[model samples]
Target: MWSLTMRASTSVAPPGAKTTMTLIWRLGNSWALRGAAPATSRATAAAIRRFIPIIPLPVDGVGRPSLRFIGRNAFQKGPSTVSETENVFRPATPRPAHEGNGMPQSGRTDGPKDPYLLASLHRGLEVLDCFGARNSWSLADLSTHLGESKATIFRVLHTLEQFGYLAKDAATGRYAPGLGLHALGAAAVRHEQLRWQALPPLQDLAESTGETVHVGILHDGVVVTVQIVDGTRAVRMHSAVGKRSPAHASALGKVLMAYLPDGEVDAVIAAQGMARFTERTLTTPGGLREALHRARLDGYAQDEEEIEAGLRCLAAPITDHSGRPTAALAISAPASRMDPARVAALVPQVKATALRISRMLGSPSMAAA
Candidate 1:
């Protein structure tokens, strides 16, 4: 029920000069340390250690600090009445049900003490934890499961609904996990599957073509590289996993955009304007549309120094079981090594690798079609 705020400020002098850090802990109207000395750069840890001892913390018989909240009455007595509240400060005897371990009945470590922890936030999470085994929950159901009052559970549910973490049925007043949770779970699953399936082919493609290979997915109109295999060539193009690139200018992005619906592609272009990265970058809508048309027809996409000067890339789409382009696999190389003849030769190899990955994902092939 109490609110606590903490802020830290650091002052750095010129190179080789001493740095000073000030930690401010505010509890409502009171400051825990009014004019504590600024901690030097080297002695910050020592300063914190010095401050912790004066905190009047309760330690167990073994000499370790025991952090447990008694009640609001304990805080009301203040620091001067420490001796009188010694019994209140001692760790509460664990319930009979959780006797083996020192942990509470919930099997969770008593997290931070009450003053620093938000009871409401913890209750809200407890409500969410209940939904793991079921599709939906009513207020009474969550209240009983968490052993919290119905009114408290209702407030938590309402807050979760407002944040799109839960959706409430208008007719039944029941709550279920929302689209936000589904989106997060789906993204995690898709990324894991894509990386697992793409790694082998990516490594093979890199070794065969002697060029850097990447597996990327479109997220929020950007190409997020999920996996990468560096080429054997000493001067090959370099890129790292988890790097994000403009979806409009990269081959991996273009291949993904090519397979997506026209409306979605337009939405991406509208949201992330076609910022030119090089002279060859397609900045106009009509030009990009034409390029996508070519990519769709040729079953692959090409980037000729569009994203970065002196670099060339070719990419093909990896489809999911539903036949949707879930990710793209691409090969990148220096322009000198990826001349027109070399690119033409590599195109089929990239497309083949992509098709193999798509089949692994359970997408039907042209022969089946």
Candidate 2:
């Protein structure tokens, strides 16, 4: 329902004269006008004073961005605009619970280490986690799951919707997982297993080869080194775990990228743009695709100073029980020792070790391309 109220002070007025009017307006559950008044004539003033409408205020409320988005100089042309919205609406995208020290809702109740900050954000994530079991849920459903109120759930859902973690289906009035959820899920799943299993193999490789060895998994178009086993020898490569190396510059990365479905591999190369790392790194996707093809056929891949000036690496795909490569295991040493003959000597050993680890992990022969 809608209502309009006009209030004016009594004044001397002729029959045909105008007057000033003050209007208060409201819609269902919302107040649109507070106290807007217009100046007019004397007779009109009396008429306006008599024109008061005794009506009920609107009953429904309109949604608005919280104070998080408000600013005094909202449209200013100076530094005042810098404060802007400050990410309160979407709060910094939450890292997965598995990341850092953040606890999953299913786990601890001790809360974040920096408990004073991001507490509300942790609560919001708990709400998102509730959506994991069901495909879609309404505010009431979320409230029931999390023991929160409909209003609270709605606010969190609205904020999440704005942030792209959840999307509301206007037709059904339910919220479903958004693309960001899918991306995070994919990233989590892809890293969850391959990385853990690769650790033992990398350690063994470093022990056997007396050189630095690493296990890298492909993600977002790059081979991110998630595990590294440093060489025991004093004259060994110095690199850290979790460092991201280019697919083209890395023998293991190229082989891992190569094993992806052709179209998927092309999509990755297109997105990452095969820029050169070293003169020996494959600089073109077509060239890489060919290299991948050869790696698939040869059962091993090599980087001959492709990543760094004095480094060479021999890599073999770690096959699943299905015999398809899920990841690549590589041994990296100085070019002085990992020359053509040395790589040739190590290739079979690398392949054999990778096969042993693959079998231990229960991967089928189908992992081979």
Candidate 3:
């Protein structure tokens, strides 16, 4: 694998200016991040904003590129040379893949070409991508999405399973992602802007209500906490950052999902199979839709013991500069303390903090600078 690392440096002294950020892109073998340096500043880094995967091209004409690079193969296979395994370990300048039509052009290969190997690896990545937001998967779904043969996908799955990158559900015969993959993903997101930006609001909400405050983002059709602030109370609540909850079950999740277009919301619900978490939980798709409708009308969402047996929550969406709510801020506490009157009182403060963070992110709001 080729490693491309770009480091930004302040060229010269500009009055009252500082090196605002540094982006570190470390390419690793086996498709993962190995290590990283300390954070300098969040403002200047470009790569940290998002780590877009470098598109992998195949040696054979399997994957195709778009019109902009119509003839360019996403993967380039170099000339095969007779070398020992030890000799093959050395790095060489990688050539771009061949492109003819809008597809990767393959040459007549009697054996496995380097490009084909890389392309196969990339396809395997695509298969891995399919298992996001869920813990398990079925073979048929993986095959259908990747357009790869079941046998090939099974082989890849077996390898990933062995490597602890994937897990097989014994009861359902479905394959879901493993913990190791999640660890890597968690590491990546820790470097993300949204994660860092969420911390202050989370802390503020927690301090204000003396309850657990969570900052969740929509992922894989559900709302998941990207950051959390534990409460000050002795019996304070605790939640893991990556814990997944139904969009309709948690105040945070529903309010964030409510901001999405109706079609998107319906699609997510359809795919996830809206199940009631409690008697108070939204039991039907229609009911969930109505809840979302209410949330939009009131600019907030409420979960009255919808998920946990004795928990109550209130949430407000956090928007970007364009006013698109990509995340939500929520405070959750035991129902005994977070009664309807208390929850109602906290709504304005939660909304204010959300708006504060939104304004910090350049969100267009009455509170924005």
Which candidate gets the maximum TM-score versus the true structure? 1
Q: Indicate the worst ten consecutive residues by lDDT in candidate 1.
A: 16-25
Candidate 1 lDDT over 1-369, as tens digits, reads 554322222332344332222222334533242122445675775765554422344333332233445555655534433455465455542333324443223323244356676767877776776677778988987666555678988889999898888999999989999987788788788789889888998899999888899999999999999999999988988889889999889999998899879999999999999998889999999999999999999889988999899999999998887788889999999999888899889988998898888887778652254
The clash count for each model shown is 0, 32, 7
The 10-residue segment with the lowest total lDDT in model 2? 57-66
**Model 3 scores what on Cα lDDT?**
0.67
lDDT of each: 0.75, 0.66, 0.67
Backbone clash total for model 2 is: 32
Off by over 4 Å in 2: 1-126, 130-138, 141-193, 321-323, 366-369
Candidate 1 wrongly placed segments (more than 4 Å): 1-152, 155-187, 366-369
For residue 77, give model 2's deviation from the true position in Å: 52
What does candidate 3's lDDT look like per residue over 1-369, in tens digits? 543333333244344333322212234422222122347677534454355332221111211111111121321322122232123222222223322224322222112236546766666676676665445668976665555579998999998899888988888889878887988886465436667887887787788678988888888888778888899998766798898888868898788777788888878888887787788988787888888889999999999999887888888988875678888888888889987688778989999888887877767763444
Please state the error at residue 354 of candidate 3 in Å: 0.5
Stretches off by above 4 angstroms in model 3 are 1-191, 366-369
Q: What is the lDDT of residue 275 in candidate 2?
A: 77
Give the number of the best model, judged by lDDT.
Answer: 1
